[model samples]
Target: MHKPLLTTDFLDRARRHYADEEAVLAVDGTRYTYAELGERADRFSAALQARGIEKGDRVAVLDPNTHYHLEAAYGAMQVGAVHTPLNYRLTPDDFSYMLSDAGVDAIYADAEYAANVEAIRDEVPTETFLTNDADAVEGDWESFDAALDDADPDAYERPEMDEDEVITINYTSGTTGDPKGVCRTHRAETLHAYLISIHQEITDDDVYLWTLPMFHVNGWGHIYAITGAGARHVCTRGVDVAETFDRIRGEDISYFCAAPTVLNMLGDHHAEHGGATTGDNDVRVATAGAAPPEATIRTVEEEFGWELKHVYGATETGPLITTSDAKRHFDEGADDRFAVKKTQGIGYLGTEVRVVDEDGEDVAADGETIGEIVVRGNQVMDRYWNKPEATEEAFSERLEGYYHMGDLAVVDEDGFVSIQDRKKDIIISGGENISSIELEDTLFEHDVVSDVAVIPAPDERWGETPKAFVVPESGDPDDAGATPEELKAFVRDRVADYKTPGEVEFVAELPTTATGKIQKYELREREWDEEDRMVGEG
Candidate 1:
């Protein structure tokens, strides 16, 4: 017998089998069992129904990595409403656009971020507004806890849902333009959770730390995977290096996900504090957003004694179609393993990842020929909500039926996919292709460089030359400890002379997204602002 794989099945399973077990350790130190969490979700579902929210209606959630996010999301999905999560770091304008575009019926905003929503109350279609602390917010928002307390848990009836029905609408980061809502079916989400559970090695006994935001691709789909595994979630409002270490030690966190920038921050904190950052438990950290340099990976695995799994994908592709955790390729604790883990690696089970050329043919496995990465997987998003042209363009650009990732990569002889740079971020200087990622990675190896971003700057002679933005270890550009010429010579000695950065600017820190990925587009915009057109264009 085939059963529909609904997203609500995860919470139902946790409530059934792990009812009395600890489900969530809230940021404020409140402990909740699966039974309690499930009941809370049910009450929220009742509250939403009382507010006139029905099946297929959009319910937006704007919060940090708190327990409220999980409750709100599961509550919305339990009643078959579309679970729409918003980045708390976004501006009022961003929320206005997303809420209006999604036609959100109700929204649960965290007390800290409710002001943003309040600022745009008149612009959106939402009528029901709730916040964790109604007293803290200066608006007509109701208390989330008060609503739950007033509602009966058994009053709401769950509508029948099919696996093909859209249940979640994740908004893109909108780096290039207005954010588009990515429509994902219950099948896509359920299958993605299962894939991550197998690849991430999540277990019932594991304790998961929430360093990654729940707003990002549903915390890379961990909200369901960890819950379905009967694991314990250790929630936090935000990531702090010291707090991360403390939670790992105190709570015995076995697994967590973070961007490479967060790993770098932890590494720096560990370096300054010595062995105090280590916990008694063996930790497994899954990192993405960008490939971690070999040096950063070495620090995480060798020094911190944690397993580092580098995965890759975009928000439109389940954000986790590929992983570098394949054990058959390299021996544990070997120096060569870092090189293997440095690549995006092979695709997950049942996922088809390919590096294709302009003609949609697979590139040679020479690790030198750069091509765009395309994927066909059950976990990929179905389409962009209300944007038919963009949806068609995404899947039909490189290969029909396969989603184009817009990332340039290469495959080694062993079929490991290694990303080089974004399609638009690749620098073309004097008829030569230069990967900004390669340049940044090289600069990251320098002793004085704490963080770095590389972009193509407009050059009169070469059309476009690489420029480096370096965040020094001293945190001050004037006292960076290394001259620009010395850094230029350093890269010149390691890579091809032409690939060396033509200009180097030291900064306090590189601009990063809410998820800790550096915003290279911001740097590119600054460099090409005066130019009429970007390089490699007529």
Candidate 2:
């Protein structure tokens, strides 16, 4: 009765049970049922075989959140090829490096980004260069649609797949250096999909909006979880506030995932537009990449009548480790509910999460002690692709088996995990540790601050001091927007003065990865460009 777990089973289930149900609502206004989508995948798989793509060969997909992205992923993986989803925002050089590094044999790109691959086609070792746009092919490149048309859906056969085999390799955004590919096995991905479904309470009737990019950890494994539940997937070209509002009302969207920054944009837009009717559709949103401020959570629940679930995890951890659910808090007051919804709640089912110190011992649950968040579960990745030393180091500085999350956090008495900051983003000022995330979160309380990033700046008197870069809502620059002294005074009453930034630099925008994570390293590099080392010894 025991069978190997594979990701393909999810798609198969959708095809079998929900064959005639609407599966995808593409940005181009095309809708496909589960049966139709499966047929397209079959044709794509046959086309890959015709083009000489063999088992275990890497096939790269470069596109936005589109039906083509989903089809390419299911098609490539069904025939035992390893699917690699590239970040379309990356430059041609990055594409070339990743293609060569992964030994990619075939590439399928969207029309908007095919030129990026074309620029580096000669430098990479890839063979088949195909475009989703039938009319956009250039020199030697084939049309993806035409190939799909020529291929027979029934001719392609599924290979005997090993659950332990790597199904997808997702490259990091590489804010610091060249990106590293995180190899995700079929077993891990399947388990992660189940976790997402359980935590998000997905159902067949639920409609999922593709606010998150599919290339990022396969949309945090929602692609499998939603499809497995026989839910509807509405794909958008990209995240847009106006488009999101229209879809939520028009399509009656039930669930979606996005960063806190995106949530803030939507919330701000909703406020400006006078609270459009969601039309009896109970919307639930899952947010990560930083906890939304208590005020943002309050606005979302009170004004829009939407539920906010704050989850936490990294790309290496199958990305669905912990969720902040309001039911566990047992609080009824508005302030108490808002505060509880803001913390990265408790561990997901079958996951063990802890905040531990350098000694590998658990920190006290007093909520004051900060430590690295470590976790272990079926969802954790087996290893980084071709980087044994890096893989070993990732699991080294911890207890025997747990993987370190590199994020500093504190577990409260109720088991609520709140992230203080990333390990590298912490600021050391006069021998006292300061959390830049804490400062950023506190600064977000200011109405004028649309965005903010905090980093350590060289301070002759205090080793290193906290410095703040802020983006004002009014688009004013050079302190004409919000004076540094006014912002400093605002924070002085909220948190410890030591935690407050010594200097505030107003910028139009903060440097961010394509995934919308603030790149503190870039800010640090600029501040320390003139200095040999960041800080001096006492």
Candidate 3:
């Protein structure tokens, strides 16, 4: 029998199986049961419908990870409305573009970002602005909680969800031009959640911490999987290393995912206190976007006493097509062990992965030949919203049938995938293709660089060259703490001389997008304004 894929159905199942079970734990230590979550979601859905939001309407949600965010998401999903989750850290301009492009009819924002919505609210297609309570700021918007206060608690009976009908329209972290909306359906989200659980080994016994924002690929598909498994959810509004550690101990958090920035913070916290004792910490950390450096991975395993699983995918790909936790045949301490942990492993069930040369021919899986990565599956997104040309560009211009990942990679004989570099981020210096990831990894080895981003610079003679934007660890910004020349020499000592940055720019901190990803495209624009192509898209 075919099981339902819509999230409301999963909520119904969860209510039946774990009605009194705790579904969400707030930061202040309040708990909401699965049954309560469903009722609250029903009230919110009724309130939304009262405001004229109906099936197929687009409702944009912008907030930190919280209990209400989950309720709003489930309510939106239940009504068959397209849920558009925005990065709460985005600028007014970023929000404006996404809202106008997605044709958002309503928006639910937290108080901290109410001004952001106000700045562009007139231009957006939305009038139903629902702001949640935070430190109060005056706005003419509806109170998020108060709206549900008077609404009927009775559950809504909307049209049944079609697996093929669009359920979400997630915007990518745009480093270059406007962000593209990746439209996904019920089948894709539900199927990908199952894949994430099996690959990450999540079950009912696990207690998940929401460190990753729910807006990103629906919390990377864990929202569905964890709910299905009847797991407990601990909600957090922000990431603080000490608070994270305390929660892991106090709440007994078993699984979570965050960017390497968050992981580094936790490692620093551990170093300040006594490091994690063996088998004392019972948490699993999964990271993605790009494979973090090997040292960061080893630190979590050795110091935090946690197993770090690395994977890679983009917003357009449903973000679970590749992972690195597949069972291995080799011994534990072998040199290849580090290599295997670094490579993005085989595809999830029902997904196909391949690497091909520029000519569209499959490359040998010898772990040496670098080529573009491609995938196609049921979990793949349906298409870009209102964008036929962009959708066409995504699936073609490289391969005939596969969705071109645009990331350059290679596969080993055992079917493990290693990212050589991004084809777009490569530096063409003196006619050499220098991998920016290689240079960034080597620079990270430097003791002075706290955080670093590598992009390309325009060269009159060479056409393009690598440029490093570095953030040093030393506290004072006026000390001339770490010079660009020093960083170049640091890289020169390790990698080939040609791979070194032609020039390094020192900054107090590296700029990151709302999602905690280093905004390489903004840095790329500063260095490559005169050139036709960016070293990385800024």
Model 2, global lDDT: 0.83
Model 1 residue 78 lDDT score: 97
lDDT of 2 by residue, 1-538 (tens): 9788898898899999999999999898999999999999999999999888877999999999999999999999989999999977666877988999999999999988898889889999999988877467555778888999999999887889998999999886422345678999999999999999999999999999998888878999998999899999999988888999899999999999877667677877877887573745899999876566666687777788888888878788998899888584756545677777777789999999999998999999999898989999999988888888777867878666888878778889988888765566656554344667777888999988989998888765554688999999876766446699899998876765666799998888889999999988788878877764332111
Per-residue lDDT tens digits for candidate 1, residues 365-454, read 999998999999999999999999999989999789999988888899989998765665666554344667778878988999999988
In the range 61-163, model 3's lDDT, one tens digit per residue, is 8988888788888888878889999877666777888999999998889888878888888888887988877347465788888888878867466777788
After superposition, candidate 2 runs with Cα above 4 Å error: 174-176, 275-277, 425-538
- Which residue pairs in model 1 clash with each other? none
Q: Candidate 3: where are CA atoms >4 Å away? A: 1-4, 275-281, 333-335, 425-538
* Model 2 weakest 10-residue run by lDDT: 529-538
Instruction: Find the candidate with the highest lDDT and give its number.
Output: 1
Quality of model 3 by C-alpha lDDT? 0.77
Misplaced by over 4 Å in model 1 are 425-538
Each model's backbone clash number: 0, 0, 2
What lDDT would each prediction earn against the true structure?
0.88, 0.83, 0.77
TM-score for all models, in order of appearance: 0.81, 0.80, 0.80
TM-score order, best first, reads 1, 2, 3
